[model samples]
Target: MTHRIAAFGAALLATTALTVTSLSAETLRWARAAEALTQDPHAQNEGPTTTLNHQIYEPLILRNMAGEMEPALATSWEPSADNPNVWVFQIREGVTFHGGETFDASDVVFSLNRAMSENSNFRELLSGVTEVRATGDYVVEIETEGPNPLLPNNLTNIFMMDEGWSVENGAEEVQDYAGGEDTFSARNSNGTGPYVLTSREADVETVLTLNENYWGIGEFPLDVTEIIFTPIQNPATRLAAFLTGEVDFIQDVPVQDLAQVEAADGIGLGTGPQNRNIFFGLNVGADNLERDNVDGANPFADVRVREAMMIAINREAIQQVVMRGQSDPTGAMLPPPVNGWTEELEQYPEFDLDRARALMEEAGYGDGFSIQLDCPNDRYVNDEAICQAAVGMFAQIGITVNLSALPRAQHFPLIANGETDFYMLGWGVPTYDSEYVFNFLYHTRNDGRGSWNGTNFSNAEMDEMIVSLSSETDLEARNATIAELWEMAEAEMIYLPIHHQVLNWGVSDAWSTLVDADDQVKFKYFELN
Candidate 1:
């Protein structure tokens, strides 16, 4: 009764032959159970969108699932001895873009500068980045405000663009691809990674081919001439497609389908620890709100009220029932394995309705208060169900939660704009560090730039600690700073961290080099054996 596929190739041939026969040469077809709003890497937050861009665009530095930094576009980097605020990087050589443009200092400079520019959603992502300069054709130097230690981690998301292609196409604007058609970088790729983008059908499917020009790694040892990605919205439909051999891999296997996937033969289920932490963020800055008949007031402005809501919700029940034993309930905002920064903090606390009631009564909410909650139906495992469970739990303690579950495309902008009083979100650590989660989600102010502090969770002490951790090069001192940040977040309940769900990447057994790193599945690293 094992769910392992036997003679998987023959099975795939039987199911995919119908449509794959018509697929162009060197094409690999994959599937997503949802849709993406744009092809731009900097603008989107969902997992599926990130996987697509990772194939075509190479970030300056790459990160592993354990949050360690590795070489990618940048070969090596070190801080300037004389200038604690400045860091220097040696760009990898002999690399060319898909359009035959060389990778060098100029591209690094342009990309970093663009990321920090105004109106670009990545601006906060480049915080404290004062200047980017090319000391040599293959060497780039970055100056920051302080002794920033997380620069390498931050470098993992500043994707390098072809200077020549961008300049010629007149797309130097910071947000040129925010919501536009596929550009040269989208449909084609000239990265130093293992794959190249060959074709893209917007939200439907995208095809990629192994990069023959990849300089770091020798030609990938598989014969996957092409990789095609497809987005299907229904869980049953996606599972049906996989069971029928119509697709080789599927992302985010639904909770209900886990047993079926494991029990079926000729199929395999891949699971690992993901960096994402699902939580609810409150708009503490919102001016218009009803809190215990107090007109135009925000209860979330008080730490006590925020903490009360955390105690009222039952994280354990969600983990056991709704999550179906697929999650880890947490007290800290950042998950474990994010370096030594995850401290031993107080638990999120058992769900004590009476204690919650007492706290609310003290905060002038004995009768509870009404607030709007924004949620995305297709973003996380049991996202809507989790929110609904929270709504029911809160109702038991007198909190009225109005739930609205919409698609991610529409939900992202609204939450980023602070249009929702509260919302459900799962953040994957792009840098694999606690600083990435703490600074981006809790410390930084939500200005709709690049930072994810959409809930306006701000504290001067936390902000100072984040800045210090960013510039501190000493590992011990940096860890100490990270601990301070986490402690503050726990004390303040900045974000109610649910369990770090196990990432399930169900794919064909023939796909090699398919390890789960950074909780992302890049088709470039995978090949049909």
Candidate 2:
């Protein structure tokens, strides 16, 4: 098992690693398992989407590959001396968007408000903010509902866009990604980051060239002048691209090909435990599932069925065979890097066929039932395989699973639209906090939170507990609340956690970089030999 506890812990209470890149390569071709959902920065809060955005967009603050807090568009930020609720950020001077628009505090104000809008996927992260205003030419003030100590942490991936450019292009509104609305911003972008978008073909290829006028010209290596990114969903095809030098770097090297990649000359395999976990979401709150054949009653609504399903599939076996020993089997959603993770919380119950069948019988499901398990074939490592394995395991408990695997682009919508009874999802914590997980995954679907909560689980009291995390200033007390919330989420068994994902990046010897714990690659930090 990938060292289940090898992450940075509170040290990540914590962010990125910066290594010097020499001037050598002018172009770098990158390949990953999936592509960004959209070019609109706030459209999708998915990991691949954010990672690609980091190359073109600039956030007020960002986590480097090492996972450390670093300055980006904002030079410095601190809570106002007169008001604990207000956070003041000093915008970077002389910085301009790709379209040459000057960056200022007004742009910051506009971008934040846009991110907090109804269609934005990032609204949950900024739900505590009550107001955002330009206090000066280069000073922006953000007032939260209360003292939000971890405000900066949430800003790590909240990228900023040019206010003037966005309005002119009729992209003032965020993309309604889950609703399948595609606007101008979803195909084009203008950011103040190290690179500028040359062309984007969505799932086909995206070309980016370095911004010669970027503010960080002297501060960063700026060696890689151009970037050619391709998303090859097939594992074998992606690996072959890397081996043939058709691609310079591969973000996800399949576990089955690790030995081949390691043995290949001029290739280096970078590995680390990512701050993400893979889980199966069950629609337990629904009175009757939309795809199950259990009459008017939902089998998942019963706790015994949920628990039985949870303990039936052997995680250790999946870790060894499905993942090929590149995963850490776990029961908790929060990875080791997050603020609320504890060893005790990761203790998953052992798989027992007899117990699972008995529980199924107790839940009046001993005769078994059929359910459709929606899964993504290109999203995570061995994602479809894991679902396929579960299908067999479920059969032992008299539950028949009908597997429906699709590309990430098609599979995610089913969850968002509440069209699937069961699904597979992976979450990465950019904030390195538990509040982010609870707000999006545990809270009841409402104004800003629970946008991804497809399970239909809702609890007013638990929702209150989840909401209290942003304003609770006392660290010890806030963590206590997190523990309580975790207990509640676990007791409900809304999701069955499989494991924390392990990151594997294959790099050419010509360039060097670390396996970013967040799985985000910043080309500016790539070191050339």
Candidate 3:
């Protein structure tokens, strides 16, 4: 199945190259299962939100379709020869914001500082930065705590914002996403990207028009002049929109209907591996869960109970049945391509219901307990169904799981605010490194890091290892620390590993676009025939 998709992709690439010369301007109607939670660039770091924001905002560094780092707003960057802790960046010249403000180093300084604020969800990505200074009109310098080589990789998604525009609109500070506070920046945007936001009706539709004065006008394939994006939560309605030509592109193609879409005329299918891992999180540090049957203590705090829950989940069965062979069962939190990944870390004990039962009995949970499982129905592929399957498996062990499925907008805040006892989440490492995972998921929750660590698990030794990876210049030493941290994470069962999702994009035959491993659809790369 993978080979067939690769061949089809190659053929599509060939067709795209042959048709580029004759491409024309057209309106691209795109649909997805969920809408971007907010338009504030620094509020949310989720995939769907970032995908929508990338069209209007420009980051200092950009990850191309092939997952390679490339220059975006910043033309060139390198460590300062005089000081190893300071990195110098040369901002692009003559770039104007959508509202006609000139791009400069001050905007860069303001944007980076804004993202490092307490309300910014992207603060974890910039935890190592000590300061950001504008040396000149177009020259900026970033000083880290120590010698950091992966700073540029971390900034791939930290979008730049115009300082003047934000101040004028009374949105100088980042939106408090977890607090549910709405700001002007959440609905209005003025960026220097290839597209300008013309109309934005949250959760309904968004309209964008090409930036005629974009810096990369001729460098990219910017053939689509207008974009009309709609969020259709119902899978049937989304598929119907695609089938009837109401929508030209669908980022998420239903796995069950892949065959039907492939066999249908004037529809093209592109499949690839996504750089994300879906997992289950438990509040292991809490003395007593806020929403569970346990009386005085949290059952998840017991390693035996965690182990029992881990084995109760049959990942192979979920892969084959629920995912329809569209997922790769994984044992590690990070995917194989990420740094610090090894075959030894990928091995998991085979599923055994009998062993799980014995462990539960040994942990004084033979009678089992009931707990609420929070899941997002529209976030990941078959997420609610996966949770439903786990509920049944857990029932065999005398555990009753009350499933609570909600939209991504409502479901994420529950985890972000540490309100849910158990929840489902999917993580993607944009930096392609284990340090990115450790910094956000394993580090202790604090002002500088662990914004997403809802599990409430913390270790002083593990925190030391995680912090050392940022400043350690030696490659072997850094990797060793990463391995040690993973060893602790696996032994403690910080998160129950599920599987890596597969990317399936459904597009009309009238257009061609690359399938990114991150599942980000950049319409700037789209070519219309």
Candidate 4:
């Protein structure tokens, strides 16, 4: 009996491996509910495309399972004793890009410089570094304008592109997600990741294969890999694909289908509370056609109007109707895990229609006003439904929100350029630090940098707090700064924190390894059981 059981277990292992290996000979077959809109990481900041880009490009540093920064292309880094602002990194030797060209300090320098150069989306994240220099063959040093300590985590998107491949392909600058002319980085990618992009069918399918010459650990146990991404606009159609086993994984699982999916056989449901906050941004700085025309100015500018809008939002209705009880009404941008930052911060004023109407009246809008609410149709979980629900809630207070739903590729640029009035956005903390929030969303503009502050929101005190928080080595002081920052944001009604989404992925039992970090899936760690 013992020998028979041993033979059976061996056969099972072989069977599982064969099941994965027989898919496409050179490509492992994987499916997701959505397709990537763009292959460029710098160009594609939306959620769906970010996942596909994960398999195609390799960031300078990748996060480990514990959410800690680990070496990828860069082996180690050190801060200068004389000045905390000066930092140096040692690049790994003998590493090569996917195109067979050797990797060096020049690639790192070029990538950083390009990301920080003129008219780039990533400028805000890389703004602290006053200078980035390639010191030696495998060495690079960074000089910050001030003591910037979030460098390690910020390097997550600092993906290294092949200088030779990019130049050879005539791809110099990254593509504009909006309606920009053309650029090389817009389409093709050259990286040191585990997979290579064989072909990308925008909004339809993207296929990748194992990079045999990858520098990191061996290709995940799966021999060849193929990522099939399809963006389904209808929720029922997407759920049907997963139900019928047409697709292995669905990208954004609908909340209403949780119970039904749990009851299904041969289908596995994985869920975790995502470290992302879905919220709304009001244009308090400028006026657009999609805004309230009555005031002829940004209504969000008045703290009273912003506070009223926040109160009018019935988060419970949003949770029950749209989320289907799969989300938590978060009080702040940074979730609870990152220490005392969110401890004392008060949640946005609860859904009080009367209070909201009263505030609106106080702001000289007794009859309320009409404004356009720009939202992404396929970006977040039930994103359109959430916006639709908001329409009803806001209407109760006599505020007519004209909803303009568009794809994220277009929606992001429209809002980024300050063209939208009121918009819905889902933000994930890139650095896993509260300080990341202060820098990207709050800090006053020193130059043309600082992302997502399209509201042109500025506070000199907040800027000083962020600078002090960045360089302060003491954990307690840094956390205090974060707490103070949240308090100020709350007092000022910076951005409305809606709810923290619960991430759900529908998969088959055949796939064993699954790591859902902040809902950003990296395929390198995925392996066949």
Task: Give Cα-based local distance difference scores for all models.
Answer: 0.68, 0.88, 0.87, 0.69
Angstrom error at residue 204, model 2: 2.1
| Tens-digit lDDT string for candidate 2 (1-529) | 1112345454652232222121237788989998999999998999889989999998999898788899999899999899999999999999999999999999999999999999888999999999999989999999999998889898988989999999999999998887889899998999999999999888899999999999999898877889999999989999999888888888899999998987877777777788899999999899998898888899999999999999998999999989998888999988988888998888899999999999999999889999999999988999999999989988999989999999888998888888988999999988888999999998898899999999999999999998899989999999999998888888999999999898778877677565788888899987677
Predictions ranked by TM-score, top down?
2, 3, 4, 1
Model 1, span 51-100: residue lDDT tens: 66777788878753333467888888998878988888989988888777
Q: Give lDDT: candidate 2, residue 493.
A: 94
Best by lDDT: 2
Candidate 3: 10-residue stretch with minimal lDDT: 14-23
lDDT of 1: 0.68
Ranking by lDDT: 2, 3, 4, 1
At residue 24, candidate 3 shows an lDDT of 22
Worst 10 residues of 2 by lDDT: 14-23
Model 2: CA > 4 A from native: 1-24
Provide C-alpha RMSD values for all models, in order.
6.1, 2.3, 3.0, 6.6
Candidate 4 pairs with clashing backbones? 28-224, 28-225, 28-226, 34-230, 171-184
> Which is better, 1 or 4, measured by lDDT?
4
TM-score of 2: 0.96
> What would the per-residue lDDT of candidate 4 be over residues 165-258, giving only the tens digit for each residue?
8778866576766655467666777788778877776666666777778776552454336655566767788889877767766646677887
